[model samples]
Structures are given as C-alpha cells and as structure tokens.
Target chain A: MKIKKNIPLIDQHDKNGFWGKFGGNFIPETLKKPVEDLTILFEKLRKDKKFIQERDYYFKNWLGSPTRFIKLENLTDHLDGAQIWTKVVSDLNGGAHKSLNATVHCLLAKRAGKKYIVGDTGAGYAGKMLSMAAKKFGLKCKIFMGAKDIKRQKPNCDAMRANNAEIVPVYTGSQTLVDAVSECMRYWVSNCDTTAMCVGSTVGPNIFVKICGWSTSQISKELLIQIKDEFGEIPKKLKLINCVGGGSSSFGFWNEFMHYNKKQVEFIGVEAGGPKNSKKHAAPLTYGSKIGVLHGAMQYVNQDAEGQIEETESISAGLDYPGVSPLHCFLKDTKRARYTAATDEEALNAYQLVTKFESLNPSLEPSHAFAEAIKIAPKLSKDTVLCINSCGDALKDRDILKKRLGK
Target chain B: MTVSPISLAFKKCKKEKRPALLTYTVAGDNTKKKSLEILNSISKYVDICELGFPHNTPIGDGGQIQTASYRAIKNGIKMKDIFQIVNKFKNRKNSKPLILMGYYNMICRYGENKFLNKCKQVGVNGLIVVDLPWPDNKKFAKKCKKKSVTFVQLLSPTTSKKRIKKIINDSHDMIYYISMLSTTGGKLKISPKKILENYNSIKKINKSKNIVIGFGITIKTINSLKKADGLVVGSAICNEISKSINNRQNPVTNVTNIVSLLKKRIS
Candidate 1:
C-alpha cells in the first residue's frame, strides 16, 4: 500500500503549537519536558516509514478503516432536499472513531518504552478505546473519570474494567470532563516518567492536538477516495457536518477537505446546546466564549468574568465541556467552518428520526450533527450532497436513552 | 537596580544563615477575615508570605490545596476581596513581603495590566502564576517587571539544562524550584539530598537570583532542605487550616504555631 503524500492542514501549527494563535503548550513546568519529548518523538514517528507502515496496518486490520460511506437514501427521501450521506465511523472496532487515536498513541507509547497508558474520558468512549488498545499493546491502563460520569456511563466503565483498566474516580469541581482532564494532568505530572497520557480529544496541549488530529485524519484520507469512487468526481457543492465536543471527529473528517475551495466544500460543526429553554448549554463556539486556558491549551472557554471555568450542561456527557479544541476555535475565528448548536430536544428528535428512517442509532454527540443536517438539508438543493460523521454508536448511551426516551 | 522587598527578605535570610521561611495559605480559605488573620499571625515567623487566589479549578494543586481553594471559593472569595486582604496586610506595620500565587486565567480575566497594578497598589512584591512557564510568561513577566512586581519563575527537575539557563537568565529577583515531580502538597518523592542537588544545579546557573524550593516541603522534610536560599511550605499550612476548621479550633493560632515550628526547624 502506497502512503499518500499531502501536507495536511493539521500540520500547519507553528513550533509552539499555535494554529494562528489558538493552541499553545500552556502546561505546568513539570510537564514541559515530557510534552516536548512527545512532540519531538511524534514528529519523527509520523515521518518514519516503519512507523507509518505499522500504523497503517493497524488502521486496516484492527479498526476496519475506510468505514462505509453510504448514502442515507431513506433519510434523504424523508427530508426531500439534499442527498444525505454518512461516513459510518461508528462501525469501527470499539464502536467509535476514538479507536484510531487510541491505537496510534498506544503504539507510540510502546515504541517510546512506556509501561503505562493514562487517559481521561467524559463520555467514556475514549477511555474504553484506550483501554482496549492498551490491552492489545500489553500496557497497563488507568482511566480517570468523573464520579458523575461513571454513574451515567456505567457500561463503558464496565467495558474498561473488563479490559483490565483501572478507573480512578475524580471527585473534583463539577465532577465532569473538565475536572477529569485536570486530574488526569495532575496524575500525569507525577507519573510521566513511566506513563503516556492519551488525551481523549484535540483539546489538550499542542502535541496532543497534533497527535489526535494526525491519527484521525485517516478518516478524510479515506473519504476523499470514497467520494471520487462513488461520484466519479468530487461533488460541486458538498457540505460536511460533524459534532464538536472537543472537535476530534470533525477535525478528522474535515482535515483533508480543508484545502478545497470554501464555495465548493462547506464545513459545518454542531455543538451540544443542552436543553432548548436553558442557557446552560455546552456550545462554547456557538455561544461565543472568550479565549482562555484550560487543561494546558488556550481555546474558547466557558468562563465567568472572574476567569473561573463555568460548569456546562448537556445530555451527552461527551459534549458537556466548558472548553473546545483550539483547532476548532481557530476554524471558527477564520470563518473556515460554520458552527452552530443543536439543543437536547433537537438531538433526541434527530435520534428518533434517524432510527425511524435509516434504522441506525448514533450516539448523542453525533446526533447533534444529524440534527443540524436535518434542519439544513431541506434548505439546500437536491444536487447538493451533505455528509455527517456518525462518529460513535449509541450502545453506551442506553441508560441515557432509556431514561429520556422511555425505552 | 534598586533592591526589591523580595530581594531584601532573601538578603536578611542570608545574613541570618538560614533559608527564608515562606508560608502559603489560600486567600479566604475559611473566610476573608480568617485568611487575613492566618496571614498576619504566620507573618511573624515567615520571611515571605505567599497568598494563593482561590480558583474553582486549580490543576497544579493536589488534594489539600484543592480543598482549601474549594473552601475559599465556597465562601464567595472574589478577586477584589483578595486584593483587599493584601491591602489590609500591607497597611499593618512590619508586614513581610507578600506574594500572590494562582493560575493565570484569573489574571488574564482580570486584565493583566490591571491585575499587576492592583498587586502593586496592594503592596504585593511578587507573583507566581503556576501554569505560566517560560516563553509563554516572557511578556507577562516583562509587564510585571515594569510594574516593579517580581514575576517568579518556576524550575522543575524535568527542565532541561538549556531551558534552565534560558529561564534563569530571564528570571526576576526570585525563582521557585519545584522540589519534585508532583503537585503542591504531594509527599516528597525524592530525598532532600537529591532535591538540593537539583536546586544547586539551577543555582549554579545564576547564583545571584534568590531561588526557593517549594512542593512537598512538610515538617519532616523542611529541616533537611534548609541549605537552600528559601523553602516554601504550602500544603502543610492548608492542611492545618482544614484540620482546625474540622475540629472547631482557632485556625489562626494553630496555623501560626505550625508555621513557627517550621521556621524553627529551618533555622
């Protein structure tokens, strides 16, 4: 298999990890050396032929890459406007696109001679994938999860435990993803010598964002080819939509298509808006949050005037975060992508509609993207093709769906 | 350049042949008044006073300091109230040099120039933003220098020699050496001898800078690290306050007593 040679948009960050003044390494002094080492090692590994071959082998064999890109014909007929399609990343092993990053990082940790892999999770998909990957790579895994999230995401927790990963319950502020990341960083500070932190999303310091983005960019690398194979040419007017919690899947899905003209290819990112009538949504980018540092990266953050990070509310635990990925912040500022929010009610409605029309279940995170796509599909012409990234399956969200949707 | 109050305190400690005893307590740990009382009482034995601004999320801190910050923020401690405490501390006679330490988001939210000006107005001699390390802090440190506020640079065991030279070269009158690879208040992971060894390597880069060792500096470990220019005890003090609050004792007396004991041990 020949490796493609194209400069990815994710590699445009400066030496300090700033993507036009969005991301930087705003970490503690103890993490400086480790982060720098990881950066150097990642730069070398990404360019190494052997490393690429190893990563590609796993992408092909383990994760079932080039995940099905199928047109949602029934859903498109129901909407009666644009041709709706989906990159079914939900079909990947571990049931989410997170496996791609987790596989890459676990491999990197193995090459770096690390004995332990540590990570934090909000929705538990990342944690489950990391645990599975760590088990595959024969490394010890410890996952830090918020106590509240542990209750809601019990199945994923059980999955992680089944994979022999230790779950460290974080009882700090808000008992959510933000605090979990903070605690994970604190734990990494003490154990960095023997541990590699597989940050869940593109929301951490420069190296993490770069690593996650690079690993997940395989999504678009496949989608670009699938698009040509299906349509015999890139569609004249195409819209790619994906949900943005920490914006990993969206960045992955949009990275290769970024170089296309904005007129020909439109990028839309949907954020969780919590409840319809409440102001306590996790739509930092859509709500225009100020730039502030959280978990070692400067990004659009939901912070009070006094700079205290505010607690976020969303039905999807994965999207219930106060800060967004710095790369998404950059894309929002540069007008390279249009960002909006889908309230919980709209997302639930999308989940029901997609299940009824297409017989497919998406996690609430990507349900936001489907909600946005459903809303806008009717406004576009029939010739227009809109693709949404179904990044994860809703199996782990059964408790939430049962409670909210009454089974 | 004229000597700053922080430099003067280090000089006094050098004259006495002892490491300057620095005590850190979160501002408004239990309440604004009690926090100020703790500061005032501890200042008698402390060479330099470090007051931390309570944050909702203090990532660099461990469990003890996080509890203290929660208590302070629960009591509705605001930025203005912290500045008021500093102002009141400075109003008293013979008050030691006070340094404000916290995460940088608060300063960024409060406006860098305005926060530094408020520190200057409240007699804050130095500032230590834990998350702001080298290169990222260069501009803010320059701003602090212009305002006569020493922006404390932090050195860790993990910092490379090249980076150490760069940080020490750009350091102000005072530098803080994190004694180990842990958050504030963690148990000392390395022996005092090893910590001093690391400290000496950084001191060799610039002996003129007043360097202090912080993190995991508890009662059992303070005496062994007395050979350094200064030693900072934060988690132990915060733990004492927590104990006093839980036991319904006067935190001021109990905290001051422990600080005095730490000072004696270092001496």
Candidate 2:
C-alpha cells in the first residue's frame, strides 16, 4: 500500500519524535529528559564545524575511511546484466562498516562528558567494534547480548572481553537481539547520568536515528565521489542494494543518494528469508508487518495478533531480528524504496559464489543483497549500474558456515 | 465535573487524613477467574486498583512485573481479556477505582478510539499509559476526557515546576509522581523528604491535590509516604506473587496479604 502522503522522514519531523509516523519518542517518563537532552546535543554537534573536522580526521586516520569501491568484473559478467560495483566495507577497521558509527558516537559520549558507553548487539560484530572504540576513547563499554547470540558468536565475545568490555547476557523475551535491545534500554534508563547508549542500529528514538544516520552517511558520500570518478558523470539509473538487520548499512549507504538523487536512484533493501514453508523469516517490512512501538521507536514489527513481538528466524545471526529501522519502515511505507528478501540457502550460496567469483569472503549479512542482486541483475538492462555494499566480512562466520555446509 | 471513581478515592483519602493504598497487578494473571478473585479481594484492602494490560514487551517494567505479564499472556490474556477481568472486578461487592496501566504500543495497535470505546464499555475510570506523557499527546488526553476516562499524566524529578503545571493542567484524576529516575521495582534512591517536596509542589497548582507516588514503596517506605493522597505498591506486591508462583502456592493469597499489610502500615 502506498503511503497517503509521501513526505520523506528527514523533512517531516514535526518535532514530537515523528518520522512520517514511523519513528517516535515512545518511552517512559523517566527517560524523557535524557532523550530530549541527547536530541539537543546531537543536533548541535552534528552541525558543529570543528566537530565535523575532528570526526573527519578520525574517519581517515583512526577508523579507516575511504574504503575502496571496486568493479566486480567476473560477477558482472556472470550475471550479464547491470555493471556491478561494491563498496568494500570489509577493508575498514573492526572488519565491518559498524566501526564508523561506533567510533563517532564514542566521541559524542566523551563530548557529553559521559564516563561509560552502553549498547546492544545482535550478531556480536557491532558490540565488538563498539568495545574497541570505547577502549580507544578511554571509556567503559557495557554490551547487552542475548544468551542465544553469545553462544552463536563466541569469537566476538572473546574479542569484546579482550577489550575489557563487560557482556551482560539477556534472558528475557526471546533471548535474541530484540531482548538485548530492551534490556539495554532498561540499563540506559537506570544509568543515563554517567552513560551514553551507543545503540547498534539506526533504529531507536528520534535523536538516536538522526545522529547515527547522519554520522554513518559518510559511506554514500565517498561512494558518490568514487562512482563519479569511475564514470564521467553520475549514472541515471544507479541501484544501491544493501542487506538490512536494523538497517544501519542501508540507512548509511542510501541516505546521501536518496537526498542527492531522489528521482535518479533506486534503493533496494534485503532481509534474511528463513527456510521455506516456515514462520522463520526476519522480513517484517517485506512481509506483512504492523506499525508498533518497540525499543523507543514506532516502526514495523513482526508482532502477534495481540501486538506481541514474535521471534524471528534466520541462518545469519545478524539479521535475526523482529524489527527493522524506522527509516526503512518509512521508505517501505512511502514507496521511496524497494524491499526484498533472500532465503538462508540462497544467502549461503551467494556467500560461496562471491567468495569464488570475487575472491572475497562475504558475510551472510551482505550476501542477502548479493543473493537478490543475482536474481535482479539477470533481468536488468545493460546500461544500468548496481552497487552492492559488502557491510560484513565473513571471517568470523567460519564455524557457522562449516557446520551448515557439513564440510 | 462528574465524580469519577479516581477523584472519589482521593477525596475520601484526603477527608480521612490518610494515604490511600493503590495496588497494581496484571489482569488475567494465572487465570481469569483467579485473577478476578484476587482483584476483588484486593479492592477491600486498597482504595484504588491499577489493572495492568499484559503485553509481550514491557520495556518500562522491571523483572517482577515482566514475569507477571508473562504469566498473564501465557494464560491467554488479550487486550479484550483484560476488560473482561476489569468488568469482573467492577462487578464485585466492593469495587475500587480501576485504572488500566500499560505501554502505548498495545493501545496504539488497538487504535485510540477502539481502545477508549472498550474502556468506556468496561467502565475503566482512569488510564496511565506509561509511555505517553503530557507534552505532545494532549490530543489523546482530550479523547479520554470525551469518554470520561481520566488520562493520568506522570511527573518525575526530571520534570520542571513550569512543566509540572502544564502536565497537571492536562491531568484529570491523579498525577503519577515517579519517586526515582528509574523503572518500577528499582530501589528508592530519593529521600522521602525530597519526593514529598516535589509532590507538594504539584498541589500548589492543581485544586484536587491528587497524586499517587510509586516506585519502591515497601512496608518500610510506606510510613514515610503517608503525606500523599495515595501510594502505588506494584513491584513489592508483584514480587510476592512471583514468589508464590515459584513455590507452587496461590499467588492471589500472597498478593492479598502483602497489600493488606502495606495498607495497614500506611493507615
């Protein structure tokens, strides 16, 4: 269903935490001041010229900015449709694009005079990256992880422990990323005096989504320049595809382009599709999802008939969440973007295919996008150019892959 | 103004020169019949009853209430079922003022009009939506006024005196003054002297002077909270219910006993 009014989220904040009826500050009264204070400080810092320069310096020198944009010649030829290019986020420090926002938010926390950084994570990559950032920034890091996630991503837990970050396992609700987020909110509410919640996704209250999305938009800025340098001019039909858990990468990757090329570009967001004939997929927006409030934002959620969130299933640990980012919720609502899904088997197959075709081991997170690209690329005309973001490197997922393949 | 049960309860407490016991528990906890029995018996001890609508994700709640919600949901309590439990409580011999307290998502999912219609049909006297406060959602508060369901607003230490009057102007029956800057069941970090200071500041504006303070009001804490019109005892009572459930005893008896004990001490 097309949204009755197609006002973009960034332009439509009536200031009561509304993002086109998708994002809101639906939180407890004790948290009201903290949310508003963060909104005020984040807006000031986002526009500060000195803060921007310092952040740019850290982006280049500390967290590995200007990651490469590469032409996937073999994959493009194999598909034989659109000219395919990829933004290699794997080259960034912490082995994923997650470090960008984590590092930036750590600076925000220090500027706010916060002594500790607290966050929630799904697949463990974000928590590890945030822990490393916290260690470097001279702050204490506390991560809330699901017991289920801790078991699946043991290597990430070890890395977080090595950085001296405390991991608090959540046992409530489904004991997945959704519960981790809820638990982290309770912790943040109790300790909002001395701590800043460096939320993992671009899905939180209004202030959180705004600050995180703007900071992470560096990817699209760099990708824009690289694409311009590759082709003499910006292409008319540039397709930007990225996999989404809570949609940090999709929000970051598509934000700048959507602003710069609103009518000129197509944004494609993919989610983890569980096995066939099962209620396991994590594609709430792609599938039929209702608008409800969870973890401080009103967005699309895979809730039961009685408005209770349901546990989602996926082979990829990162994408196994019931809710998506509110911006994606807005995009899906307003027809500003296309939403799709890829099954676990298909994502795994894409992981292997890309490993062989590009000699780059891709995480199952972005492999969902690659999986969809393979389907859509074969049908697109030759002049169209598609950009896929390799947001996660598959190095940490070796054990899961080995077990799934039974190799 | 029509005499709403919430206003009546506060009026009675003020005339009697004692704080009212406002007890809270989720409807349909364990079972529909048993929860109704507990609520009816609980009405005899407390001056007002806060009925919680059990939700899947109670983000503002601590562990004890979350566990109560889990049991209530497990017992097949829907939004509609909560009303059935409320009607059962209202139909009892000694019916107390009933306020439905819950997160906003469930009501937003139920839609505002449909939920208010259900509240009116079930004779719900007041509402304490833990998430929606006074600043932006006055439209919702207006709708509740049309239906005569008191849209209870919250005042925390974080709220300023200037903002407190505005919130009090929006409030109808009672102002839920959160005693600390934390979720329910957290220890009372603020001294009773400081909490009463904030509570009395609100009485300076609103004529009714009705305020119910909650969050860490134990048997020991109840003595110091008698200056207010009412005190909400939720987590302490829920903790007793959880203990009885774990010990395979009757949760209703345990809850009724603690509420009675707290009411006696406060009086």
List the global CA lDDT of all models: 0.92, 0.85
Query: In model 1, what lDDT does residue A267 have?
Result: 94
Name every residue pair that clashes in candidate 1.
Answer: none
> Candidate 1 on B108-218: residue-level lDDT in tens?
889999999899898999999988889989999999999999999999989999999999899999999998889889998889999998888889887899999999998
Error of 1 at A292 (Å): 0.8
DockQ, per model, reads 0.81, 0.67
- Give me candidate 1's TM-score against the actual structure: 0.98
Q: In terms of TM-score, which candidate is strongest?
A: 1
The number of the candidate with the highest DockQ is 1
Kindly give the number of clashing pairs for every candidate: 0, 0
Clashing pairs in 2: none
Q: Name model 1 segments beyond 4 Å from true.
A: A1-7
* Model 2 lDDT per residue over B92-139, tens place: 778988999998888888988999999999889999988776676699
